[model samples]
Target: MPTREEVIEALEAARKKLLTEDAKKEFKGWNRTIQYYFTDSDEYWHFKVEDGIPGELINTEAEDAEIQFKMKEDTLIGLIDGSINGMRAFTMGKIKVKASLKDISKLQKLV
Candidate 1:
């Protein structure tokens, strides 16, 4: 398992990647908040997107989160590093997402 800091770093990297592509328009244009909960770290990482732009990771409380994801640190790193596919992780029961199918698909495309 990675430390909490590693997880936060990975999430930050993902945010940068997401913001650079058309995927950002598709994913964050919804102007919603997404929260990631790591079971191993017992920490919540939040991304607040506004008009197709993603802001900094919110280490504090997530306000009005529209999507939530639960996973362990290893799986998150693998997914973020492109070593593991998000769909495969979900199907293999390594990751669990709580969100609408439309929103999930947008994020999956980004990853």
Candidate 2:
């Protein structure tokens, strides 16, 4: 299990990744709100990616989230920090995602 701060830190790192030039190219024309629900901590955090730029993380439920992920705090931390692979986690049932194939594929770049 991970603390709230650790999960936040991991999210921040993902946001920072979107700041890179390559990331901008990769996520171009993408605008979506992604939410994460931590089962262990009962926490909700969401962020928007607009035209390749990532918005600040918000600690609330998303009004119209395009992609939603349900998992434990440790799983989220591991995914964001590269300790866990996203596809592997999903396949292993460590994470559950509610998203379209295209949307899910796009997010694979984040992990």
Which is the leading candidate under lDDT? 2
lDDT of 1 by residue, 1-111 (tens): 787777888888877766776866566546878888888878888988888788889875586788888899888889878898888889988888878888877776665
> Which pairs in model 2 have colliding backbones?
none
Worst 10 residues of 2 by lDDT: 102-111
| Candidate 1 residue spans exceeding 4 A from truth | none
Q: Relative to the true structure, how large is the alpha-carbon lDDT of every model?
A: 0.80, 0.85
**Root-mean-square deviation per candidate:** 1.8, 1.4
Distance (Å) between predicted and true CA of 11, model 2? 1.3
